[model samples]
Target: MRQSFGERFDVPDGYLNTASIGIPSASAGEAVAAAVAGWRSGAGRAGEYDEYVERARAGFAALVGLGADRVATGPAVSALVGLVAAALPAGARVLVAGGEFTSVTWPFAAQADRGVTVTEVDLAQVGPRAAEFDLVAVSVVQSADGRLVDLDGLRAARGSGTRVLLDATQSLGWLDADLSWADAVVAAGYKWLLSPRGVAWMAVGPELAATPVAAGWFAGADRWAQIYGLPMTLAPDARRLDTSPAWYCHVGAAVALPWLAGLDRSAVHTHCVGLADSFRAGLGMEPAGSAIVSVTRDGAGERLAAAGVVSAARAGAARLAFHLYNTEADVARALDALTP
Candidate 1:
């Protein structure tokens, strides 16, 4: 409908080059391009590192519904996880939703050294049974099925003392989320956020500001200012959790959010839904989710990969992920490519 805008985004003429990953945009490119020039000219944001950090903080706050200062920028989500895990008391029993991306689990697993107890939700008994754990965590969206989980409903299930954390990497840019109940949240810039894959995570409640177990030079009064010895007073906010965030990364992420926000997010959601729905209708393949779609076909994973149909093998099914710019025709092309 808005060809002028669509042309600027460079939506593909065919099936999206994005599947099982995020689609980068012009704003992202421009940010990195500036970084290159800044680096070569030695004119980077040396004095404005904190300013960039503030920019990142504001976006994180706006996107996830947290205070700007409460957002912390790390190198990636993994780094953010490490900071969270480091801050938590030892022997905390962590309850996570049944299926989570690797970033959520691996860090907790490593924390076994700290006597952390990690448990996956028994989706079979997922009601009040989950109430037993001290900490509860879930992705905003299902990584496998790609279903958007009702975060508010789940967080409300826990007592006030029971902390809730959200992994928002999958749906940050395109989907509207209710983050009121979360104690902390984490995301990356790679996919939907459309920025350099700089890491960022934030805790909403003041309780989490008590500990930022991992500290780095960038976490200081002067961003580039070096520090020795242990971390001092827990940053009154999420800044404590961030060790290092690329200044240019802030510029890129800032540039991307407006464009993403300007697009009809509801329309983006609808188009993705319709495309997944149509893939099912045309191919007679009942696929799943807005982010990832799956059509069952035995031994077809290898075959499809060979045919340049970028996808993944999931729970005895083939999962195809689509994005904002993907057209129905692209779905048809993929369906055609997969046809026997």
Candidate 2:
């Protein structure tokens, strides 16, 4: 039999399915369900809806150990990243890891076209190149093998002038990863945070909030109303970075953050590690410490997909991501489904 391993959180029945991509959910997602229902109907922008959206920003900030004012909501992770690129200077030397998820990689390419000098490097070697780049963007966990990068070291290496954008989609809820060093972080509510797919958030530090490049209409403080087709004075925090209304998505993302806050992150981390370990032990796969286990083989993605199991490819390996909602039995079931 070929080797197999899985995280208990990797189980697919959860709201956020890591089977498709990124981190598995760590909480329930009732808020999003309500938000979407409201959007679908003509409910459109109600006061309660807007309040929940703001609450979601606070909830997201709470999870990352930041002030609520520092968090901003987006339509999706991709849109949040676009805002980041738009905010940075056109000539900024943006550094990204080679072989990152395309969502991250393509943004830089577009940034390059707009004038940012984009450099893709092996992040293991980022410490050396950090001083030269104006900004360093990285996925908290490598999307392929779920390799956890030393974010603290990376931040220090960037020196005081550089901005660090960390994508926590793969590692946010479970891992004991410290995000205090980051200037900005964008993550999807679906992955790891247990919300649905429509929500994503970006949190910015105090310094960046004061002077953002992509200043949006939704960023103003107080009860903002149109004053002759112009934006009112902006808010003091990260909300200023948000350009449009993502009211519905906010409801779900907000609920997910606090719900995850109830569970023990340390326990979830241990559970994920243990489940990954169990899969390796039973399947004889080489043990990789990530919440994900991946391997290289011909037609690997196709093979797994055909078996009713979904996995993503990175370079030569196929990755199976896991998280808090996954159970031991899930690994077994997926393995059975994948039987060749």
lDDT of 1 by residue, 122-218 (tens): 4343335456766666677666656666554556655546776777877776565567457778877777676766655555566653345666666
Per-residue lDDT over 200-311 for candidate 2, one digit per residue giving the tens place of the 0 to 100 score = 8888775542244555556666535632465457776677667665565566566667656656767878888777666655556766667877756566566666656556
Q: After superposing candidate 1 on the true structure, give the runs of residues whose Cα lies further than 4 Å from its correct spot.
A: 1-7, 10-20, 122-128, 150-152, 221-235, 262-264, 285-289, 302-308, 313-317
Pairs clashing in candidate 2? 8-326, 8-327, 9-323, 9-326, 10-323, 31-252, 32-252
Off by over 4 Å in 2: 1-45, 113-115, 209-217, 299-310, 313-316, 335-340
Cα shift from native, residue 56, model 1 (Å): 3.1
RMSD, every candidate, angstroms: 3.4, 5.0
* Cα lDDT listed for each candidate: 0.65, 0.67
lDDT of 1 at 138: 65
